[model samples]
Target chain A: MYLAQIHVTYKPSILDPQGVAIKDAMHRLDFDTVTDVTQGKYFEVTLSADSAADAEAEIEAICDRLLANPNMETYRYDVKELANQ
Target chain B: MYLAQIHVTYKPSILDPQGVAIKDAMHRLDFDTVTDVTQGKYFEVTLSADSAADAEAEIEAICDRLLANPNMETYRYDVKELANQ
Candidate 1:
């Protein structure tokens, strides 16, 4: 089995209202040093594949097709081998 | 300035409907090797601090107080020094 940890974020040119809201809140909380905030999605997935390359390809396809919206967001992921459990 | 990359995840005991939906989609797409999926949040923040330790503490506070729901999610972050951008 392999575990994939995915992180998805908005493209730099995109506007992120949620991130803005959080940044404002942080400022209100007196963490005024925070200049910018960009919020995104994270996913942890467990899967089995015949080879590491296959697992990575499957995950890349998954991210491109479902987990992220190509128009506004980009994603990256790390895959780790897991012991049978 | 320092960039903090935050990742928040639901505890193992928590339910993740979005993840389940994605997993189902993956299966429908014939990636049936996928066994489980857990969804969470990610954030990229830019801030300035006098020291790395201070920046980490500030981010930890932000996660605990605002970025993450203490009752449902746990968070971790990595801080990197920026090249002044």
Candidate 2:
């Protein structure tokens, strides 16, 4: 088995109203030191594959099709091989 | 400075179309063993503060405001103090 960790985030240039809202909330909550809050996503997946190569292929497919919105979001991933796999 | 690691994920009960699409993509890419792909987010922030208590307060503010979607998504976070801050 392989473990894949995926992250998805809005492009920095895009306007993130969610992030801005969070920043405003922080200011109101007395946490004045926090200057920015960027939102993103993460995924930890277990692959039933035997090797990293096999797992990478699968993970790439996942990112391309579902994990990322090619137009609005960008994704990156890391894969680790399980000892027992 | 303090560092915050924030993770956001879709509620387990919610339909994760993105995750499903990734799974299908994996299958098509010859990685049949990947059964699921649950997506989430992560954030690492450097705070301009000196203590964990202060940093925690700020990070909590961020979570409430922008880091998480309280309605459809769930979030969790971890904080660590940096040596120089």
Candidate 3:
């Protein structure tokens, strides 16, 4: 088995209103040291691939096709071999 | 400055329908090496804290108060001091 941890984040050019809202809320709650916040999606996927390379290929395809928007967002993933299948 | 990367995921006992749906989509896409999938929230927070320890403390508090629902989700974060600050 292999495990892939994927993070899909908005490109720096995108305006993230939700992140701004969260930062504003943090300030209201007096955590004023917070200077910036960016929100994104995280996914953990377990695969029954024969090798780590195959697992990574599958994950990359998955992210490109479904998890991330090529224009607005970018994604990266770390694939690791699981101790047990 | 400090940067904290926070991830909030559903507790093990919680049902993740979104994750199931994503996995189903993956199967339909013919990239069926995936055996399981879990989705979560990711946050990148920049703070002007005096030290990494302080930043970590603040992040923990932020997660507890706003980023995560204690009843259904659990959060973890990594905080490191920025060289430019």
Full ranking by lDDT: 3, 1, 2
TM-score of the B chain in each candidate versus the native B chain: 0.94, 0.90, 0.95
What TM-score would chain A of each candidate receive against the reference chain A?
0.95, 0.91, 0.96
Residue lDDT tens for model 3, A19-76: 9999999999999999999999999999888788888888888999999999999999
Please state the error at residue B59 of candidate 2 in Å.
3.2
Q: In lDDT terms, how accurate is model 2? A: 0.77
True-structure lDDT of candidate 1: 0.92
In candidate 3, how many Å is residue A43 off? Answer: 0.1
Candidate 3 ranges beyond 4 A from true positions: none
Writing each residue's lDDT as its tens digit, candidate 1 over B1-85 gives 9999998998778888888998999999888899999988889999999999999999999998898898888888999999974
Best of the candidates, lDDT: 3
Q: Which sections of candidate 2 miss by over 4 Å?
A: A83-85, B1-3, B8-31, B44-46, B51-85
Instruction: Give me the displacement of residue A44 in model 2, in angstroms.
Output: 1.7
- Quality class of the docking in candidate 1, CAPRI style: high
Candidate 3: deviation at residue A7, Å?
0.3
Instruction: List each candidate's DockQ score.
Output: 0.90, 0.49, 0.92
Native-contact recovery for every candidate? Answer: 0.93, 0.69, 0.96
